[model samples]
Target: MHIHASLRFPRRLVDRRLLLSLSLAGFFVVHSTHAASFDCSKATTAIEHAICDNETLSQLDSTLNEKYQTAMANLSDEGASELRKNQRSWLKERDACNADAACLENLFNQRKSSLQATTQQAETQLDAIIASIPADPANAAYQLKQYRGPLASAWLVYLNRFEPTSGVTAEEAKQRHQVAVTALNKQNDFAASLLKDIENDPKTSKNVAVLTFLRMTIEQGRYDEVPPRPDVHCFVFSRQGDAAYRAFGALWGSSRDSQAPICPPQGNLFELPAWKQLNKILDPVMSAAYPNSGTIRYASYADWAILRLRATLSPTDFLKPIEGQSQESPEKRISEWDDKSWPKVQREQLLIAIDPARKATMEWLQTERKFTASDASKASTAIVNAWLNEQLDYLSENLSTGDQ
Candidate 1:
């Protein structure tokens, strides 16, 4: 079943408390004073009244709003819209707290911390994008124009009068390119840190986590900005058998321009022992889940399984060319997901029935996929790793779709 992209899972109260404390750790450093993001005199709801009444809660509101505004300043129109939607969702949750000071504080702190991280990351990206451009006034001017986003508006305005034909020294551009590459490499290193969080609990990590990590790699190429290609090979290769190896490969594997010398020599990934083993595990489950063939088969959960796996499989797997496979190209395969008619009723029934085949898969996910085998043998470890990835795919298929 195709999952909705916006599904959110319930988080533990301890998670919220921990987040609140962490967010508040640096709170006083910037926000020692108290004020609400809005006018207290105009406070309407119980949630708003609570924030207006409590000094700490008012400060938290003001702090998050400040960070939110800054983040909005840096984002593209589309990004801003997404952030706004998320904030609205957060507001709904916050209002649900209704006069609970602790709940309001926790939610406010979490939002504040998230906004700060986003703004900082966007600032770093904008800086790198600026540095990546050739020092040639015209080239910079023209490239800056393409940005059109709020993040690049200042640079565009500053360089607006320059003619496209004007030139700068190649040596200067080379130095800037080197700096840009270094900045991007650092960004990748930061991404590695995020990957480490998932690696620490790969088996337990949610579908949202996996999908977010994969989405991060979607813009890896950015070749138009920096042609040298920032080296993410070390980032992925170092984490082999872990989530990073697979997540980082999603985009790099598909982009023809990304098959560069920066990575190890390529081989057909599907033929790899680990990949074949994963396929082996999935084959039966998918077959049992969707026994029918033809038109209905095209819309089966099995189809989504293939798409999700390809999306998360390591680039090393996709690096090698397929020999005698189905004639459908990758482009067509991606488009198929959106175009095919969804068999919602049959899918709903399948979810409700919980047949032996489905139960077995769930049992595997809950048990073996939770941790490596006790012996920790190389083969056992490989199988466990394969199972972990399969769990991620399974979670992606069902959890996000609310079919659980």
Candidate 2:
């Protein structure tokens, strides 16, 4: 459910919708004395003449005229002038269809749909704004301002990209839901964290308002359920291609150098010095290729990166010498997502899907073979946060960044 910016539409669409909006609002007022949108006695064109002769069309024309007159009177002087100019121009073009009933009907429908009433336009604005909000807590306060408008009942409709998804069998849907549960749970936790941050703010009233509107949707049964999260769709290293490989290679100046086994990625990637640089390279490639990619991307990166690093430096360079339960071996950790199946070419990489939060399933895959709930929780947070910070920052830039 991508909501493209309405303002980005073509010029014709904007013009047609403007006419349609005015037409719908004023079309059926049923003014008998004023029976046409224009002066009937002066009508000359075949289409204009046809409208004056037909009772039904003459009624519709009068309705459009009523709306047009009211709108023009309320508009600013410049706006009224502009409308007058555009309408005159449009009438000329419209009349070219003459008495072609199909063309005339099509024209009416196009404008009507294009020009939603004031209320519908406002609701659409809310959806576009809410959907574009940053997933990070830092931007929550600024983004919450958009929730000020009345939340349209339609806004509550399910925003999930997965449900109503066709072609998947019941078992597959169940599995996908299972994988999504963790993410959904994580999203709920994140939302709670943001609410807490908002509460600590000096302006609690403003924050509460945003939450109230969101709750309205739930109560109205627009969304299927709370805890919004997407299903895990692929392995961490699942995405790779010549285009992706090119972006990866560009991380280093030369292709050969980028592919030449380098361990521990040249520098810190998620934060500080390398953060901005990494985002510049990763954002476009991710958007064009793996827009839906998630936690797996970061985890898989660690795997292959460590695999390459093992080529030169000792893998032990990566770990702490802590005892038993807490101790981490770089070799063992890398083995969690990789094995002999590692591909020579990234394009040929094999991907297997597994729920990252499912402790039992992950344990069976031998990832740290015996991760306790506490241990797994700590590991998941650390890895996921690293991934999320990069994601949030990238999203902040890539999403509709304008203040609309």
lDDT values, one for every candidate: 0.44, 0.35
Which pairs clash (backbone N, Cα, C closer than 3 Å) in model 1?
Answer: 269-317
- How many times do residue backbones clash in model 1? 1
lDDT minimum window of 10 residues, candidate 2: 229-238
- On residues 1-404, what C-alpha lDDT tens digit does candidate 2 reach at each position? 01112101234434654586687668656444437777888988888877777766776666555545434422334455766786787677667777776676566544444322422333343434444432322232233222321122112111221223223244543343333333323434332333234335453343232332233222222122233211111111112111111112112111212222212432222233332443454344346434433433443343334322221122122232211112323222323422222221321221111123223322322343245555544443333333333333333333332111
On residues 292-372, what C-alpha lDDT tens digit does candidate 1 reach at each position? Answer: 332333222332333333323332232233221223322222223321232444333333332323233333333443423
The list of candidate 2 runs beyond 4 A from truth reads: 1-34, 39-42, 112-404
Give me the displacement of residue 143 in model 2, in angstroms: 27
Candidate 1 structure lDDT: 0.44
Best by TM-score: 1
Which candidate tops lDDT?
A: 1
